[model samples]
Target: MLVLLPPSETKHPGGDGPPLDLGALSTPELTGVRTELVEALVELAGDVPGARAALGVSARQDGEIARNAELRTSATLPVLDRYTGVLYDALDVASLTRAQRARADARLAVGSALFGLVRGGDRIPAYRLSAGSALPGLPTLRAIWRPALEPVLAAEPGLVVDLRSGAYAALAPVAGAVTVQVLSERPDGTRSVVSHFNKATKGRLARLLATTTGEPADVVGLRRLLRRAGLHVEHAGGTALTLVEPAI
Candidate 1:
């Protein structure tokens, strides 16, 4: 199965890999849009204030704008290693066994506003675009990405678990892709979507699915696996699966 993750707004700085190369990324079909978005970002970087407004970043994050300016020439890191935030922290890739890591490398990928879809091993420089950010001189990111990215995701052969947030998911909605929602069940029998902690929960769940020996062919198997892992899972209709955790 191909497990799709959302790109973290935060990233770890610096890497030893060569500079960004659009052609070197996985999903070669996306190179055209990738180049377009990357060039647009680089061009936008020329005006730091303009870029700051466009990217919705504070003056304190001017350094991030610099990262965008240097995207093409900057050193790169593997897609998985580059993104750093609560979700990635919970994924805890550093502790995985070698074989598990291999499984992760093969099964994991991230949805990016700047790069579209990047596999775990794809090396890319740090970039600051978010799914909601509107780059000047281009169509909405949804318009730019949906036509190019949706089909690529739609074509994946195995089960696809999309762990992206709603904005990111709008860039491309894979047909038949299984979506997961984390909810917390209360003692009073009330339930609601968990916010902050669920990203970490999703991370741990993604790690579980990626490292395990068996692959889930469909949503049924996927739910079975999550249940086996001691999660309280239930079908939320259509292609959606809900994971319930006890309320804190």
Candidate 2:
């Protein structure tokens, strides 16, 4: 008989509010956090040597691919124009070498970690974190939000952006408070995980979305936007909205 494991849940303690008290975090502590995050990302890549190359694809490029595919296959254009800019920028910088690609990957990994931490209600000094300097014309790791987040926002405008840094800061956050559940699906089945965010963070994100798109950051509005962009929105648990797609 095949054994099935129970659904697993992990909750990270939320961080404090902004002007984040890094006082308790020593240099070594920060370094340790960064190192651990990088290692975890590398492991997540799961690309064994001589197996397959990890393209270190930029989030911006990924967003572009999604947007372009929508344009070709769907009847309407993406309601969010920023997606086009991100896609073009990603295409322009796709020729970097492996070493440069690694740097970009590192930034992306770190940026993701920061975002996760903030979403969990931690007070993070986003600018202080060493995501490294911007690569001139190249898109930064924060661009991941476009592809990873925009679809979700388009589906559930109620979801909020807690902390925005790097390229993400330029985009507005969505309004309202909503729960986010990240899920991983394998050959066997699917598993879901929950993400934590405080009310303040939700407010910040909603304000960003409202400002950027000139649209109300609500579930109905987001769903309309996403559907117009040729994306499918899945509503689960009545309140949770998920954007269905292949692993990012």
Candidate 3:
């Protein structure tokens, strides 16, 4: 199975690897658009005030524009290693066993606003861009990405589990991909969709799948695996799984 994850707004700065190489990313088809976006971002960075306005950032986030300026020259890290926050903190890739790490490298890819999609082992630099951002002198990211990215996702073999947030998911729609929703289950049997815990649950699930010996190939198998892992899971029909978290 292939798992699709969203990119984090915050990234761990610097890396031990080589600089960013468009050709080295997972989807070669994305290089053209990546190049375009990179050029626009670099150009926009030349004008700090303009860049801040376009990126929707305040004075405190001015450093992000500088990060964009040095995108190519900066150090690089493995795709998963670069992104950090609630979801990635829960995934905690650094703590995984070697075998689990290998599995994660083979099975996971991240949805990026700048690079399109990158596999776990792909090396990338810290850059500032979001699925919702509209770069100066460029078409909307959705417009630029959909044409090239959608075909690449559709062509992938095996079942896909998409864990991207709303904006990133709009960048490319994966055909036949299963989606997951995390819900808080209360004593009265009512449920509410969780935000922070939703990401954490998905991260934990990603880790479990990465380490498992028997990988699931479809929604049914995924549901079974999640249940076996002690999750209160329910098959929500049509390629959707609800991981019910007990109310706190």
Candidate 4:
């Protein structure tokens, strides 16, 4: 299965890996646009205030812009290690076993504003960008990404599980991709959620799927996989599942 996760706004800086190399990334189809976006980012970084406004960052986050400026030369880390937040904290890449880590490298991919898409094992620098941002010389991310990204994702080998946040998902939506919604069960029989629970649950679910020995052939198989893992997964209509948890 191909499971796509969302990139985090916050990231772990610096890395031991070599500098960014577009040709070496897994999805070679994205290299052209990746190069374009990367160059755009580096150029924009020359103007701190303009970049701050364009990237939705603040004065205190100037270091983030500096990261963009040095994107081509900065040391890199695996995409999974580069991103950090509640979701990534739950995935906890450092704690996974060797076998599990290998599995994760194969099954996990991330939706990105800069790279378009990246696999778990892809080495990349820490840079700042968001799905909602509009760079000065480029079109909307959705426009720049849709035509190029859609075909590449549509060609995936098996079931596609998309766990990206709304904006990233809109960047290049997969046709009939299996998706999950995390919900909370309140005492009043109402369903709602805080984003914290939603992201954490998805991260844990990604870890479970990554480590599982059996591959899910379809959405039915995917749901079975979740259910067998002890998650409260229920059908929530076509191409979607709802994972219900107690209200936070």
Model 1 / residue 104 / CA error / Å:
0.7
> Could you tell me every candidate's TM-score relative to the true structure?
0.97, 0.25, 0.97, 0.98
Residues 1-248, candidate 4: write the lDDT tens digits: 89999999999999999999999998898999999999999999999999999999999999999999999999999999999999999998899999999999999999999999899999999999999998997899999999999999999999999999999999999998999999989989899877998999989988988889999988899988888988899995689998998886
Candidate 3, 1-248: lDDT as tens digits: 88999999899999999888888787788899989988889899999999999888988999999999998798999988999999999999999889899999888899999899899999998888989898877889999999999999999998899999989999999877999889988999999987888889889988887778887789999888888889988785899888898888
Instruction: Give lDDT: candidate 1, residue 141.
Output: 95
Candidate 4 overall lDDT versus native: 0.93
Which scores higher on TM-score, 2 or 3?
Answer: 3
- The stretch of ten residues in a row with the least summed lDDT in candidate 4 is 229-238
- In model 3, the clashing pairs are none
Angstrom error of the Cα, residue 103, model 2: value is 28
**Which candidate number maximizes lDDT?**
4
Model 3, residue 123: what's the lDDT? 96
How far in Å is the alpha carbon of 62 misplaced in model 3? 0.9
lDDT of candidates 1 onward, in order: 0.91, 0.31, 0.89, 0.93
Cα deviation of 92, candidate 2, in Å: 12
In model 4, the Cα lDDT at residue 203 comes to 91
> How many clashes show up per model?
0, 14, 0, 0
Candidate ranking under lDDT, highest first, comes to 4, 1, 3, 2
